[model samples]
Target: MPVQTRVVYQVNPSMVNALKTIREQAYNASRGVINQRVRIQTVDGQIYEGVVVNVDRRHVYLTVPAMQGYGRQWDEDLILTLVLYELLVITLLYI
Candidate 1:
């Protein structure tokens, strides 16, 4: 029986810079839509519609409408923290 050894490789500096640039672009795009109603679709096919509340390097926060049912009043809004890289599309909703 032969034992297998794990090999780890170091990331290239250029690749790291490229990834940083991409992340910054994504952050800026998300920031542009802050306080505006929009629909976001994730890579996993989950759709979320809400106003962009906040954004960071790795996540976009949205304040979505809460589901109402059971004769209960939903006062608080639902906030969703979605991963930035996982977002596929963002559409602005015209009022």
Candidate 2:
């Protein structure tokens, strides 16, 4: 069987300049979308599309999709928590 893979990014919370644009976007998007759909690409080359479940000062939590037949139960490993600074772009269609 082929091994499954998922890209994850980790960085510091003080990524002000680096993540400034994204932070603002996240804030605006959160109020508008609030668990609606989102598309995010990161420096690590991960492409994710999911609901914007939560957003904090330095991280955004996307409810992991069942792309590989995984059930709805999401453990920590399943959640795609993108570090704000490491994200290249985040697009929310419904926002």
Score residue 79 of candidate 1 by CA lDDT: 90
Alpha-carbon RMSD, candidate 1: 5.5
In the range 1-95, model 1's lDDT, one tens digit per residue, is 99998869877877888767766777888999999999999889999999999999899999988777668767889899998877878999999
TM-score of each: 0.70, 0.55
As for candidate 1, its clashing pairs are none
TM-score of 1: 0.70
Worst 10 residues of 1 by lDDT: 17-26
List where candidate 1 sits over 4 angstroms from the true fold: 1-22, 68-75
Clashing pairs in 2: none
Best by lDDT: 1
User: Highest TM-score: which candidate?
Assistant: 1
Candidate 2 regions exceeding 4 Å error are 1-32, 69-77
CA lDDT, every model vs. true structure: 0.88, 0.71
